[model samples]
Target: MRWAILRELAKGQSLPVVEIAKRLRTAPSAISKHFSVLYHSHIVNNEHGRYRIAPGLLSADRQSLDFGCFLIRLDRLPK
Candidate 1:
């Protein structure tokens, strides 16, 4: 669920924590918890009051490529 929220935020230019909670239909505290996890993992970053994907995450090229492939497969499945 945290990964889902992170991916959604990744698509956005940037998002505030409140806005992210609204979009995810979850509590702000829940969002904050997941945000903490993502922050610790260095997958997402907090800038001022907004969140964005961490620039350094791209250094894990293999993992990114694997995730892209997984998304492609998931997209092909029946909804």
Candidate 2:
């Protein structure tokens, strides 16, 4: 679910919990929970209730997230 959320965020748009939940077909509360984890980990940024992948984390191709020690590929995410 976090991966899915990341995929949505990788599109380079800041989104609120409600929008993310609607896109993923899940509950907003559940999305908030995931966002909490990502937010604390510094993987996502939150501003006025909207969230997005933290700057400098996305690869140049926008196909993966470069986390220094690991990479999260987004190309295979289901539409």
Candidate 3:
């Protein structure tokens, strides 16, 4: 799931939730849930109704350490 989100974001374009949901063949609500997880994890950022991969999440250094460490400090978003 993380890889899917990362690959989609790596396209370097912000995408609407509906578009991403269609591409992934999932419900919008499901996409929203996954997106929220990624957002709170700092793997993605939401802005102005669109989403983009966060810079720090893709750092090579981040991959070297346990990915959970980076996400630990982020607060879980309300559904």
TM-score of 1: 0.67
Residue-level lDDT for 14 in candidate 3? 87
| TM-score of every candidate relative to the true structure | 0.67, 0.91, 0.67
Q: Judged by TM-score, which candidate is best?
A: 2
Q: Best candidate, lDDT-wise?
A: 2
What TM-score number comes out for model 2? 0.91
RMSD of each: 5.3, 1.5, 7.3
lDDT of 2 by residue, 1-79 (tens): 9989998898888999999999999999999999999999999999999999999999988799988898878997665
The lDDT values for all models are 0.65, 0.92, 0.65
Clashing pairs in 1: none
**Model 3 vs truth, CA RMSD:** 7.3
Q: For candidate 3, list the clashing residue pairs, or say none.
A: none
Give, for candidate 1, the lowest lDDT window spanning 10 residues.
70-79
The superposed Cα distance between candidate 2 and the true structure at residue 39, in angstroms, equals 0.4
Model 1 agreement with the true structure over 46-75: per-residue lDDT tens digits: 899888777744323222313333432222
Comparing 2 and 3 by lDDT, which wins?
A: 2
Model 2: number of backbone collisions: 0
